[model samples]
Target: MSESMITKQAIASGFKQLMKEKTFDKITILDITKTCGLNRQTFYYHFQDKYELLNWIFYNEVILVLTKDLSLDTWPDNLFHMLTVMKENDTFYRNAINHSFQEEFRNYLLTISEELFCSIIDHIKVNYSMPEEDQKFLSRFLSYGVVDSIVYWVKEGMVRSPLELKKHIVSIVNECKMYATKHPTTLL
Candidate 1:
């Protein structure tokens, strides 16, 4: 990797390490720069703030794990894999989850989830010519429901096994599919 990439990775890695011990509020830009052996300007050159890093890590890295091979045929399995990934990064998520500004992170997560859901719905629409109104409704419900389920599971410490969570996700997806089957319409 180039020196700039190396430095950026260093910053990201350093921030990940710090997240284990300190909440975002407690971590200063200087601390991240010091830990990465980069100057403050170098850090600023890459990221505007710690929250921006958090957004990048969550959306770019984490979401890819959630959506990889994301065929509708195995969405529940993909979700299970995503939960496992989240468990591995539980410390970072927990820190964000416990922060006073947690709502910000939660909102960001929900927004990303909504976008992913819309993308999937768009795929379904293309396949079936679903009406715009029904498509919007299904996308809104599925997106909010799935994101809420994840948030609730995390809040409950993920007591259910992955298999069980998969069952729940499948049930929800099936219901939405059934609704669409019953209400299919042409997009004008």
Candidate 2:
């Protein structure tokens, strides 16, 4: 990797390590720079703030990893994998939600989940003759539901297994497929 990439990775690593002991709210830019032995300007050069760093880390470590081999057929499995990753990084995730940027944390998941859902839905090319807005609405609804399920599972200390969550996800997807194939009487 290039030196710039290396520096950025080091910065991300430093922030993650700090998250183990301190909440995101408690961690300062200085803490990240000091942990990585880099000057404050270096951290600023790559990230505007700690929250942006957190978003970068989430995109890189979690979203990128989950979407690497993403396929429409295995979206549920990918979500399960994401849950497993979150479980493994429970400390950082839990701290992030409970201590800082709670809404942003949820919004990030919603954003990515919506993107994935919309992509898959488009690829399927539903022949149900629905409006474009309707398709997008379904995507947004399901994405929000899935993201909320994940947030709730995390909040509950992940008592349920990833497989259990996967099962629920699959069931929901199948039901939506069935619904799309039918002429619904109500959107509610």
Candidate 3:
């Protein structure tokens, strides 16, 4: 839309192409610049390093995936849309997902998971009476579980399709809630 947005998109698109062929550490600014047909200055003007660019992309996608108006009713569609976006950029994700700097991707997942868990806590508050401390604790605890499951799944080569995995995650969250109800003593 705007000049800055176009530049950002160019950088992201360039990075995705470069990543398909090499590791993140191996990627240089020139490589990205050359791919995008932009000079070094433009690249630096938008991002300090590859990591920063990666983070920008992750944050933009997370916001696009999880809208501010989301509720429990729309969370599934939002989640699915997020996965669809990821799959649409599968080359980018597969590269990052399987790259040497996978910790970056993990960090991205964790950050988004935190936001997702906060939404869950909000939904819980709407339906039940819970203390602020309890809400944060539950959200963080469940978010960690979801984050770990996603990391494990990604490492396992994503054996299931995006849609199937979404269903699996939803089921896992539901089961965790059931378990928590049955074993209230486990809450810490």
Best-fitting candidate, measured by lDDT?
A: 2
lDDT of 3 by residue, 1-188 (tens): 99999999999889989987887778999999999999999999999988889878877875556664667677667767877777676667666667654676666666666777667656545544566676678777777776677566666766667788789878877776665556544556
**TM-score per model over all chains:** 0.75, 0.84, 0.81
What C-alpha lDDT, on a 0 to 100 scale, does residue 168 get in candidate 2?
Answer: 91
lDDT of each: 0.72, 0.80, 0.74
Model 3 has a clash total of 0
Candidate 2 deviates by what RMSD?
2.4
Off by over 4 Å in 2: 119-127
Residue 42 lDDT in candidate 1: 91
* Per-model C-alpha RMSD: 3.9, 2.4, 2.9
Show pairs that collide, candidate 2.
Answer: none
Give the TM-score comparing model 3 with the true structure, all chains together. Answer: 0.81
Model 1 lDDT on a 0 to 1 scale: 0.72
Estimate candidate 1's RMSD in Å.
Answer: 3.9
lDDT of 2: 0.80
Off by over 4 Å in 3: 118-134, 178-188
